[model samples]
Target: MRRDTRNRLLEAAEGEFTAHGYPRTTVTRIAASAGVSVQTLYLAWGSKRELLRGYLESALAGDAASPEDAITRFTGLSPRERLVELADLVGEIAERAATGWRLYRDASAVDPDIAADWDELQLLRHRLIARVFEDIPATALADGLTPKAAVDTAWTIASPDSHDLLVRRLGYAPGEFRDWMARTLTAAVLAPDSGADTTM
Candidate 1:
């Protein structure tokens, strides 16, 4: 089927991009890996850049419900509980999408189009983090910390860059990273009496 072929091409593109890096990855290699003709690969996605974009987008999306929808379920929980839930959600996303994000970050340095796309993705990520902060009452925020600051703190902590540093380079298990994120976010963003277990 057409959809199956497209999926295969995208998978092949991810593998090729991961194995060869975007600059060195070729359409021919991806096509060969996908068991498709070069023309078929071209038809599915016009160029290597487009193919990389498609693959990264697919990786970010995963097969679960949209992240926006997922965040809504954490509503009404206490601020600390919400942050802990958020850490879990972000950890899962980082596990799925961090590799693709790193690829995008690297490719963006050399490709104007990828740079633009990467900026857009970061903006979307910021907006999502802001939405999570919106649910936390202002009173619960650390003294002198504005809502914007709280969102920024969460955004930076939840970034793929952080995930890469802790998990890929430093060898943190995913759960350890998630727990660290929860504690760090709670300590940084919540007031002293905001019910955060900040002992660690």
Candidate 2:
């Protein structure tokens, strides 16, 4: 049950982190939430900061799948299908990590190790997605949609953590905005190769 205990600590920590934030959250509170002692938390995760890292990593992991694995999951699809899958994942991740990410990102800025790990993870994600976008069947048709630019642009609309605004504020459902995002990114990235002016 070691894995179970670790997961319990993590879940407890996530809740505490979300409620009190990184600076205010204490290992005692998190352990209390998990029905464990402060020492247990320290032994399990080393320190409060490490516990926070574990929480952030766990939350981030959901959204951190490589673009290729994501595309493969949505398999037997055309380039458009792959593109849609990629966009959908962005929506899923942003929706879930909306709150946790805000804290994780802010906390990382002050901690070199966390910041480095955060940057590396993000860079890996960007490159992986860019590779997929670059290898689309119509790469040569891209007018100016280089893999780098396409990846940047995709991250642009999808990475803003604005899905809630689009839905709750603007009144679009999750699926609606997700569809719009997919279509929009595909157009931008593919229009160049197709010689079509489908940018929005």
Candidate 3:
């Protein structure tokens, strides 16, 4: 019951934040939408900032699961198979993030509170990705680019937005997209190794 209430509040808050953005959403509105009292919201999240933070954190969760899971999920996947899985994952994650991204992207100007939390979230996300890259075999084999550059490039290639734009929008099947991305990103991580395009 406690968890259910919390989830309801979060759902309401997410809808409110997405609809009105962080600057405009009020606690009373949020509570009402959740079918709870303002006091219940306060008890659950303490403040508008906390609620926003919680919403943002939840949105980011899909993208922040352990790196190993991501790798394992793609393990049996040929680069193409992984790419398809990644595309589906991208679609799934983006659907969840749609509203939060809007609020975070647009609310930075009107709300200092939103801006602060948004900035922190971006930093936290990047750090988690940086941590993941620290263990990548590709990073070691990659040449020409600095280690940081290679890691950043690899991560960017694997990002949801890139997948959406490249695979989903471009009309390539998810598998083809994932395979191409893996090969391209692999090249970016390691040296060309000569005649590699022929291998494809």
Candidate 4:
């Protein structure tokens, strides 16, 4: 029952935040939307900022397999295959987390509390992206591209901002965005002689 109530509050918070944005959204409104009392909401999340952070965390944790496990599965795949798999994983994450990220990004502009949360989220994402890149064989990397550079490339390409521009603003279908990511990563990260098929 507690879990269900928490989920409802989170759902309500997402709707409220999306419609009104962080600055305008209220705990009262979210509680009303969730059919709970404001006290209940506070008991669950402590503050509106925490409620928003909870919503972001829930959205990013989609129903699919955890990203860490998914990355581990990349083992033994060829370089191109790994890139393609990574692209698909990134697409899934972007689709699930984009709205929440947009909310956080916008809120962080004016809210110091949210800015700290946003910075922490960025650091976590960077660590995950670095872990993903760590699985790529060094020999497969483009000449003169250090592991750090490759991770940076992947991180930039897979960022929520990039996803918003391509998938949300530019109207690229999710699959199209994924395919583009695969092609771009292949070209940018793989050595020409790495034998990883570069055909788009």
Best by TM-score: 1
- Highest lDDT: give the candidate number: 1
Model 3: how far residue 160 lies from native, Å? 6.8
Tens digits of per-residue lDDT, candidate 2, 89-157, equal 776866666666677677787777777866776776677576556555544334756666767877666
Question: What local distance difference test score does each model get?
Answer: 0.86, 0.69, 0.64, 0.85
Indicate whether candidate 1 or candidate 3 has the larger TM-score: 1
Off by over 4 Å in 4: 64-67, 197-200
Instruction: Give the alpha carbon lDDT tens digit for every residue of 102-174 in model 4.
Output: 9999999989999998998888887887876776778889999999999888878878888899988999999
- Considering summed lDDT, which 10 consecutive residues are worst modelled in model 4? 64-73
Residue by residue across 46-160, what tens digits does model 1's lDDT show? 8898888887777777775675776675777788988898899889888888879999999999999999999999999999888877767788999999999999988988888
What local lDDT does model 2 show for residue 113? 73
What's the lDDT for residue 34 in model 4? 97
Model 1 error, position 90 (Å): 1.3
lDDT of 1 at 73: 55
lDDT of 2 at 12: 92
Which pairs clash (backbone N, Cα, C closer than 3 Å) in model 1?
none
Candidate 3 lDDT: 0.64
Which is better, 1 or 3, measured by lDDT? 1
